[model samples]
Target: MTIDESALGFGSGARAVWASDPEKSRGRLHAEETSRTRSEFQRDRDRIIHTTAFRRLKHKTQVFVAHEGDHFRTRLTHTIEVAQIARALARALRIDEDLAEGVALVHDFGHTPFGHTGEDALDELLKDHGGFDHNAQSLRVVTQLERRYAAFDGLNLTWESLEGLVKHNGPLTDESGNGLDGPVPQPILDYCARQDLHIATFASLEAQVAAIADDIAYNTHDIDDGLRSGLLQLEMLEEVPFLCELLREVKDRYPELEQSRMIHEIMRRQITLMVEDVIAVAQAKLAHLKPRNADDIRSAGQAFARFSPDLQDADRSIKSFLYANLYRHPDVMRVREQAAGIVRDLFDAYVRDPSLMGGHWRTGVSGFDEAQICRRVADYLAGMTDNYAVKQHRTLFDRTPDLR
Candidate 1:
């Protein structure tokens, strides 16, 4: 159904009219019947949960490598955290919660085994080609890589799910199809050609919430993980004014509390403060924009679920601190270097002999040109778990780092 974008007061009720409505979704590429018990977005969430890619997240890296510690956040755990925050934001805005949750759950499907380090190596290696992009890879996974159903190659998700997945981070291009920030990835462009996800437009409010939720999850958890890894000290958190404030408040409230409990109190409060901030901002924006429907949100050319200027400053400060103290620490960089080498070595090996790849990956090589072959190899490699990549590298090469 075509929505009247010129209309107003759609959000007059307790919730937002700008929220994505699964019942009024744009529908899937491969049409299917409405579920008896679940909304379209709910079905999308279920499909994501059962994907092999989702299962692989358990062994994928977040900040630390998977083998570093048992308690550190893996991709799986991070996705769960993001989903929870997304749901909370969605519910507060009176949007469809399931779409937000589904977007959150599948957002990281494209990440490589060793995290951004692995992605960097692949992108460098594939530079002559279209280059490796986790976001594009995520779109590829949901639209093509998955092969569970008898009729379709991918999950054939509702159009709304696919749209949110691609545009969760905001508009990729302008109305002219020119890149808004940088060149749009080839896979995304190609997919949009077949079924336009309106790459130039901002995504639904539910997706906007999921995007910010990602930031909230990583910022807080990375600090938590950094402390546990000894790369970050509680004292070092003082560098970020937001964390410093939270720490000061907690300390003042419970001067004699144990270290662990004090940290927990800080983390929980951080989540609460951030979540509440976004909800308040979103409510006001919805009040101002008065979106007639979800499509009006896409046309608004910005996100509804935005943090205030102060929170945005805090967000950057936290990221900068993480980069300097945790992600870029000498010990972490050493591990990252080793991880990059593994990805590069495996890419070279596979490009030379496709047989090195397993199953359907090997068989598909003959139909594509050299560039296509490299991407296929990258796809297979990108799908590997950290341990699997290490093992495969050892099997093919004379040496491999223990990555401890």
Candidate 2:
């Protein structure tokens, strides 16, 4: 069966451009030519939803650790928010919502446990072996790590989805500007290129939209979390010039707001302003291209610019506050240091010899292999919650449960 062009959201103008693509009619899977229950893009979305990495996000951190509170956002929740914001932007700009949402959902699948802190430790440990990057790890997870299907080792996602994952930022060009354009220098690009799939030309405008949405979500939500944790005061924000101006505007319009309600209102306003900035830039850039199909949209010149200078300064101010007052606070720093120690120790133990690991380590035949053993240890450490990591550290290293 072939794709029903009419079922897609691309309007007549876009449809005219989409119909010209040869691959549009091809089924999602090469093996099952007769099965056509889902469009290629839809299949991408479904595959991600069912993946181990996507499910593991529920245990990963957003800002605070995952187990701090049930109400706190997990990596999974953040991915959902990014997808929601991306889909909204895609709909507004007449791009592919399915592709946008698919990319957003899988963007953080490679993040290690304990958030960025764990990632830093792992990167240092693996520095001699080509280093570790969450983005590249994400590609590895889909392509090799996950062992679900016997028919294929990886998820076997579509070329478009893979491209979106690697080059979501844009095409990689050379310093000379005259050289041929290429995909970004990430490991995912190397893997895809080795397999002979077209490397992502550049991230589609929709992917850029997702990236912006991520920035908006994290910036605003980090502030919200900081304020809620009592590390930042409303009065302090009210005195910070640019943030002061924004807070004043919120107060004038949202009087009587308090707590989470007030914070959500402030975040909503900030996100709306960011979205407006994106819309303005995109409209201006796309005005000349007249792009109507997904390929054209992806290949069009850059659709958005960096944050305005004013916004960038304000963002830096917010980041500074978070770094100095929230992230570096004694309590937070203590936990992060402890997590780093746990990760390092675990890596050392497993990398030296897999036989040292206690539970479940003795089962798998592959456990004796150093690389496989290191990965298993990493997985075990990664599956830990913040408190669990602390407990395990105490249990194994400190020699007492009540030492604290």
Candidate 3:
């Protein structure tokens, strides 16, 4: 098969000057022959979809436990949503759609079971050794943990994909190599030593689109899920003025609409509004910045893809309301506490006896020191789905907390 350049969107004059050119990709950490039929970004997306870690997302929690309700969004569904929005944004911005979609698909691969609760538990357990960051774990997953390839342990994704995965949320360090937010995750720093991801600069415009897509997807879907879970009522949404206006519009348009349809309509409108806002903002920013190429985007010193100021304020308002009324609600917090316990218990159990972990995971772990053992245990636990973690907890301990 020969490379189909035109089919890869390169032939289309629509692609912007700043769009990532797969032909000029920085290349993968491990040298591999180029695909005859696919662009590097397309190959990256396909590799991500076939990973064991990607499949595990089906049973991982988003805002609700995977087993709680079939209707709730799991990590897989959320990733799909993010990918959809990211592709849409990429198309609108005339960037590399495949790279944006791939980044969105793999962004949450590092999340532990039970969402933030499990992450918190792992972070606390590893505080002494070096704290756990899901973002760092995500990089570790694609670069080091996965063992499917013949030559490399991880997926051996392209440099662009790896850069997007690690820095989708933005640069981790400043000019002085100091952490931008806090201490850069040890896993990230360690990986940078071997293969420099240029931790100080922004990722490609493709990655920025993926990052904002995540914000748009989660914000819209969480509210939809909250409504389904009865944790958030239509009336409660009025607390956020932006949402209140949306509610008013929905009611005024379809006064006779049923509850479920009304909720869906509101969600549709919310997603549309946010996505459009992002496109408009990004277009204006791109015009002002006039970036000549993908590298220019990285050095632009500000995010080119984001909500406008008014929408950003609205986004914050919606987030605050969700935090107060849904995330920290008595019922959700109770479940979070129970879920955190399961993670904590599992970590302690594995740390005490590495033999208790799967045979594949325990291989050569006996020679490792305490910190190494803890990290190994953390990695094993981090990969588990909510149901698997619960099952392991049941098998290991006599009593397990009821997540419900």
> Which has the greatest TM-score?
3
What is the TM-score of each predicted model, taking all chains together? 0.96, 0.80, 0.97
Backbone clashes in each candidate structure, one number apiece? 0, 1, 0
lDDT of 1: 0.89
Residue lDDT tens for model 1, 13-111: 444567787778999998898999998999999999999999999999998998889999999999999999998878767788899999999999999
Off by over 4 Å in 1: 1-15
Candidate 2 overall lDDT versus native: 0.66
Model 3 misplaced stretches (Cα beyond 4 Å): 1-13
Query: For candidate 3, which ten residues in a row score worst on lDDT?
Result: 1-10
Which ten-residue region of model 1 has the weakest summed lDDT? Answer: 1-10
Model 3: lDDT of residue 4: 23
Q: Please write out the lDDT profile of model 3 over residues 6-97, one tens digit for every residue.
A: 32333355788999999999998889999899999999999999999999999999989977899999999999999999998888788999
User: Model 2, which residues run further than 4 Å from truth?
Assistant: 1-35, 171-186, 196-200, 239-242, 292-313, 355-404
Model 1 scores a TM of 0.96
The best candidate in terms of lDDT: 3
* Candidate 3, position 42, lDDT: 96
Which is better, 1 or 3, measured by TM-score? Answer: 3
